[model samples]
Target chain A: MTFSVEVNGVEHTTEPRPGQCLRTYLRERGCFGVKKGCDSGDCGACTVHVDGVPVHSCLYPAVRAGGHAVTTVEGLATAGELHPVQQRFLDAQGFQCGFCTAGFVMTTAALDEAQLADLPQALKGNLCRCTGYRAISDAVRGVTTVETACPGRAVGASVAAPAGPQVVTGTARYTLDVDVPGVLHMKLLRSPHAHARVVAIDTADALALPGVQAVFTHEDAPRRRFSSGRHENPADDPADTRVLDDVVRHVGQRVAAVVADTEAAAEEGCRRVRVTYEVRPAVTDPEEALRPGAPLVQATGNVVGEVHGEVGDVEAGFAAAAAVYERTFHTPRVQHASLETHGAVGWLEADDSLVVRTSTRSRSSPAARCATCSTCPPSRCGWWRAASGAGSAASRRCSSRTWSRSPCCNCAGRCAWSSPAPSSSSVPPRGTRSPCA
Target chain B: MDLHTVEQWVDARTVDAWRPGDAWLAGGTALFSAPGVHLRRLRDLGGTGWEPLVEDPDGRLEIAATCTVARLAAHPVALFGQCCRAFLASFTIWNMATVGGNLCAALPAGPMIALTTALDGGCLLLAPDGAARTLPVTAFVVGDGRTALREGELLRSVTVGPLPARTAFRQASLSTLGRSAALLIGTRDADGAMTLTITAATPRPHRLRFAVPPTAGELREAVEDEVEHWFDDLHGHPAWRRHLTFRFAEQIREELS
Candidate 1:
């Protein structure tokens, strides 16, 4: 069904099936600053101002945002000026990758100077993997003056004072905010058991659900396995993920997916689908998975691989030390609670190629893999396509080379090109030292 | 998105609209964090408007439940104001969070709970009917994420008596930037009746009262016996929380007496 939404003071009419989120809606309308790190509400990357208040837009329904003023990073700037928050971010070097910067800025903009004092508490919801947050805190505190209107400009540019309201007063637009016409809501039926093998599958009952449009099982999906790894060359790594799989290795592994007219209908379709499984032994602990007796988490065995690099020999260092502090610190598995939950909208173009819009780390390893992998070309890669679609597409290749020369050249750089093949002429000289060195 | 879409009613009528799947949306601080709630409708009771801090017909101080924690901390009263100022860690989010919302949220670490229960504050709940009932703050919270408010009932205000001649408060947390692990507030009335409220360590606020100021040994026993519902979560384990609570209670008792 079609719905009308007012975003950043402009009214736009779009169609979205029930369950369509506001994050996707905003991205489709060209508010590309909203990043999607985690699809769950934990990460504040998708935070936007809905009705002038900062909120994680990933979980909010597009229907819920109807008739509301949605302000995104795009809305933060108006009439060729930078919002004070954005300018402060630039001055403070608050962002490295710039993926989480928009969300951080939007969240900070929502807070007054007094609330900004509690930087750790206010930013607890927004997670940044880079720059360590010292700069972000500075930026939030630096923007003392409140603006009465949006300061319009390209976010990367330095501009004068913001003209908008000081406090973030409404629900913000995020990646899941996109509203597409005739879009179908999709839900994945995850495996309940951590480890199991499918004996038989049936979707006949699920297909009978009134609003169910399509049901995809292992047989209906492409046999090729794709990896969700955020690496530059995925082919160099393992492509272990599949749209649907008969063997479930994890609790949240997708077994089937259903598309329906409404989220409720999709949920019902997922519930109706039945499958017989042969339960198998499972290893939940990372430590046990390394032991010989433990059940393997993957067919390759439980060891996901290890990184062992030493600046100096630890045994010799310990022998030389007067005192050695030996302790094993355990860091628990933490979810990147990005306010905007992960979501993607995919539809077939006129040429029959699938066009998907999602919030993903730009210039990530996976994007590089898409560029190099034969099966999935760079043109089809989501990040590459998105970057190329925007202006200054040619600079992407130049930046990719520059990125490789300085850093590990993984997905962290803005370069859209795939990593050069080992045999390619573009490979840097073997003796050449990296800029970081 | 539209707060105006939800009709606003006065205190009594608003409580009557509460339903199984409905949530009471106050300042939207906690509710906005987890929007996955099943509640389709929210009862916005924040617009009840501000009520004066009154020295009621009885000498007790009546703080409107809708009063923000920032206001409570900034109030002219010495003891209450001191507790409120200490409660202000960087979370000015408390500026908008109402007294009723913090209590209803029922977090053991709620700063307001530490302040109110210490001063012997009682909750004034407006039931689904027009009737009103008052309960001591200690009995109001049953456990973590639980409260004694019946369905369709609303907390209108909190009534606290004039602080006893001597009062003192102490609180500690794991990290400088973390939630409270233990909060202790001690008060000794003019009659020398001493009351110590131990919060954050347990699921519910634990109050230990003595006819007169108790020795450190006597206060420790009362605290150990009264705080049966010890909290053990990611913030802290029960053992540490218990130990810290005991240590702080003793410190508070000595300082207050």
Candidate 2:
């Protein structure tokens, strides 16, 4: 099982388990430049050069690289100078969240003049959820000198990201990249039926597992309801969510949580817990749900509230206007689909106070919400906003302020959190020269 | 969770000792994209060192199962190149995905099926006992996400004969990077015979042959009567697929005639 390979001209030896992929193997060896988005190869977030050819490390077996040479975004730079692709990315400010920047850099660096002619098709694998394709195309085109300089700059003079060099070089650290000591992994068992009531949950089998630290159900957690969405004021939103509930309104709703020594152990523990459910009729369409009698999503009613806006005299304006168009548009409810999914880490400090790190825009809200759910003193809790490449909604209970060396859980409801970057605080030292100010 | 259940990996040079639960690994593009909890071992075939492409004296080209899409598209064949363009896969996917993998996936929206079947291609299959057999590309794919591949069998290569003297292709999609809703390709051989192949709009490629170009009305009736299933999915509706397939088929017949 011993795998010895040359990475960026240095030889390293690793013993990967049978199913360990190359993305995880590289990250364990401090090669954090290779990011893991979708374990599936569709995202291309884990692209690396295997024997001078770009391949998805998430799909490649760690043992497959035993005798081959590998290159990551961290290896793009020579002794002191940045690669032309990296330099152009920095100059054009082509990235926003920068989670997909390393993958883009790896693909763009290998492009030649002939391939540049088909640039759109060439860089299609790397998905930058934040920035549009214009800036990315301009950066790649600038390197080849195939097009003239774009005209017209905005009012303010152009400025590069403060952490642009570090991002391109794969030195910037996101929430998941931060290292914590003696942390336990948590996993949830979700409901398969959209509308159902949990009749009984037997957790005795799950607690018998070897590495499982704790198994929690609705009976053990707090009973207070809280709002999962973000609002200017926490009280402005309706309190329709609890840490765990007996009634499941939608599929994929959390039923119970398992905290264990490793992710594998947690996953295994989740599968062992058995639950009895009473399935109920469900409605999938909005109009159908609003009919005279439909399964209610909430205890109160199917409809929350209606809003009617008027800019002027509607009937008079329509009559006087030359032309008026009316149409009904339906927009599907879709996830923000950030490159990084929601994640958080929490632990008790030496002072016996709780500290939680997460990626969120509502700084004070998480601290306050964590304290309220933990039933601990607000002053004793420490909450730090994660330097997200892009923000995502991490769910309730996950950021709870409970003070324990054991696992504390958080849930990602429908919250979308995006954090703007170029801040120096998020950059980890990777021994690269700073970018031009 | 990750693929934590895989416990064994077998590196095989040939199809001699293949077993059940053994999956062949070429580019690992489609294999890793979806969940494969049933797979216990991956038999690495890229190590076999099969030559990517070869041209026989008869002007037929044999494409190895391990040949990447990018390599196949870069070759000098015009019809093959046009089909490769229909893939619409990124350079990264093009470099890692194999032509054999695409055909074996048997997706209703697969562009490789459209290309190879249009040019009268055949698949070379090798079973675990070292027995080899050949089947036309149209018969190789049985249904969606289903192939005629037997357990422990490996697809060796695909053979594409010389291109037709006159060929034309038409494709339509919902979006710029979306999967093809309907693809209609027509070719006229040197003997003045014509073949029309339709893909993406059906569960399998539907091909129509004629000694000479068929009449416009005949083409429409043949498509409407022969194709029982128009292939319904998220990319396009069955009604839309049928409409577009008929419209494109007539346009190709007119252009070739």
Given candidate 1, what's the lDDT at residue A333? 59
DockQ of all candidate complexes: 0.14, 0.48
TM values, all candidates: 0.70, 0.88
Instruction: Give the TM-score (vs. native) of candidate 2.
Output: 0.88
CA-lDDT, candidates in order: 0.61, 0.74
lDDT (0-100) at residue A219 of candidate 1?
69
* Candidate 2 lDDT over residue span A1-437, tens digit each: 46698888889986766666788778877787788777677667788999888988887777778898999999889988999889888777777777788988898888778778987667767788777767788788763322323457534555566778778888876655655444566778888899899899999889899887777777765677766553557766676666677888778777887777767677779889999999989887889999988988887988766789999799999999999999999998765666765666665545655555655555567666655554556787665555465544432223322111223334321110100110012232222222211
> In candidate 1, residue B170 scores what lDDT?
77
* Strongest candidate by DockQ: 2
Model 2 in CAPRI terms: which quality? acceptable
Instruction: State which docking tier applies to candidate 1.
Output: incorrect
Q: Write the per-residue lDDT of candidate 1 for residues B63-93, one digit (tens) a residue.
A: 7777776677667667665555444233234
lDDT of 1 by residue, A348-431 (tens): 334423233333334444344334422345455443122111112212222221111111112211111211211111211122
Worst 10 residues of 2 chain B by lDDT: B1-10
lDDT of 2 at B7: 64
